[model samples]
Target: MATRSNQCDFIGAGGIIRDHNGDWLSGLSMNLGVGQVINDEAKRMLSGLKLASNLNTRKLEGESNLAIVAKLLIEVCPISHPLDNIINSCRHLINGFDEVQIRHIFRECNCIADALAKGSLSRDYGIVSVVETVSFDAPPPHAASAFTDDLCDLARAGSVRTRP
Candidate 1:
């Protein structure tokens, strides 16, 4: 769950909550922690353009299986969530895909995603693709680490999992 200050009003307010449940590659995670500094500096000057405007084509090189699964879930799924910030982000990320959408999952049933995240923390992976002139790739391994098990217990024991 998010902080109380941030309300869950998005239509797909729920998140998978992938909080480091696997045997992450500690070295990779540590390296990424440092690399993000450079990436942030490089990307710092690149935003504020219209939607789908990216300058780096290399960004579209690595697409991970987790993102593909998320994309799949968005298909043929029904959501009754609110219009919160998280959902807004998902919408932006999934823009132009008419068949895909965000949905609320109880988190207990999202353990697989959580495991993916933990695994990613140890290594960076992605498949890049292009839309229009913009280029983007699947979220990096470190970025994927942010995902969680949406309190659904799809695997594992309960709704809440401790980050490892």
Candidate 2:
């Protein structure tokens, strides 16, 4: 997910990887500096795909709150579009996976990622590089509540099994 600060043009991108059981595998927050929202979305997707590749993940499912980015991943991006290069790079990284799927999701359902992106804007991370993007093996303190809420929601929906 990408979030832009209303006070300035600063943008932040954040994402989380989860296991099939709804357990967090990893999380990322990057200070993308000033950029267009669409550009930040494409950059975030590229960053996520790269991270997943590093983890040697054979299969991946990615979700973005921006429908345009999700659609561009599944479809051809206009060559003249500003995000064409970044979107194509994302696609290239995705092909390295044995299987991959990208889809759009509602912002409300993506609270953890949203929180992470918002948090990034409040800090002075200063132009995060792809390899240097702030990564959390577990959700950070700021995202704890959203992560917990997600787990509870998943358990209640029977998407994640609960232990006796």
Candidate 3:
């Protein structure tokens, strides 16, 4: 997510990694100082890809709320485009995976990640702090409710089995 104020532009990126069963494996949020929306989105993709690589994930199916970004990943990006470098990097990382696909989803379906990105904006981390990324083994407090809602929705859709 990207927000701009009179003082500065705040960019935050967050993503959740889930197994095929839809069980969360890990989550990440980053406070990326200042950047444009497109840049931030590309950075977010790069960060998520790096995290997945670090986790040694061989297959990946990434979902982005931004259709343009997802399209860029699957299509060739012009060298003159502002996000060319980042887009290329994302493609390079994707090649390392045994299988990879990036698709677009509606914002409503991406609540947890949106919450985490918003949470990054409210965090007390100093603007100039070197430590910007936060990793969570479980859902963070700010995203807990969204996480629960997601599970409930999945259960209702029969995508996942609810606990008895």
Candidate 4:
């Protein structure tokens, strides 16, 4: 993800797991919407941790990438939308089909997907990029570094908060 162009970078991704109290964060491994595994490299990063104790239940919850991206798409697409074909296709792939509100996307307003695809591909999180179906010639120079300065300043400059 660090190799995408400037427009491709952002903050608040690749999180590490947090303690129950939210002290530390882990982007240790990715959870695809269903029982699928992507980013085996990330799985290796947290190999030493006992993640089985970290599964999501009613009391303790973790999210898949689809959940996170579907939310953002719902919120800031900058227009009213209808449940559409593309969204249905995505929903079919996603595990919790009931959770997502499918909607149409104007190609013009979906810069988020475009940016995410570039970043995902660069990081070789191909499950995300391929599922998203965005293609590019490869990111330009300074794409990753330029975004590091602004987006890396997470959540009020070193102040982390508990989930409310």
Best of the candidates, TM-score: 2
* Clash count (model 2, backbone only): 0
TM-score on alpha carbons, each prediction: 0.25, 0.86, 0.84, 0.24
**Mind giving the per-residue lDDT tens digits that candidate 4 earns over 44-142?**
112212231232311222332333233533444323434243333333333332232223323232232223333443443345533222222222232
Candidate 3, 1-164: lDDT as tens digits: 33333444677777877767667777888776666777777777787888888878888888777789889999999999888999999999999988887887776667777777777876654556563778888888898888888877742111111111
lDDT of each candidate versus the true structure:
0.25, 0.76, 0.72, 0.28
* Model 2 TM-score, all chains together: 0.86
Q: 1-164 in candidate 2: lDDT tens per residue?
A: 88877888878888887766778777888888877888887787887787777777777888887899999999989999888889989989888887777888876677888788888887675544432478888889998888898888742110111111
Pull out the clashing pairs in model 3. none
Off by over 4 Å in 1: 1-89, 124-164
Q: Which candidate number would show the highest lDDT if scored against the true structure? A: 2
Q: Predictions ranked by TM-score, top down? A: 2, 3, 1, 4
| Lowest lDDT block of 10, candidate 4 | 154-163
lDDT over C-alpha atoms for residue 138 of model 1: 34
TM for candidate 4 is 0.24
Prediction-by-prediction clash tally: 39, 0, 0, 9
Colliding pairs, model 4? 5-143, 6-143, 15-26, 15-27, 16-25, 16-26, 16-27, 17-25, 17-26
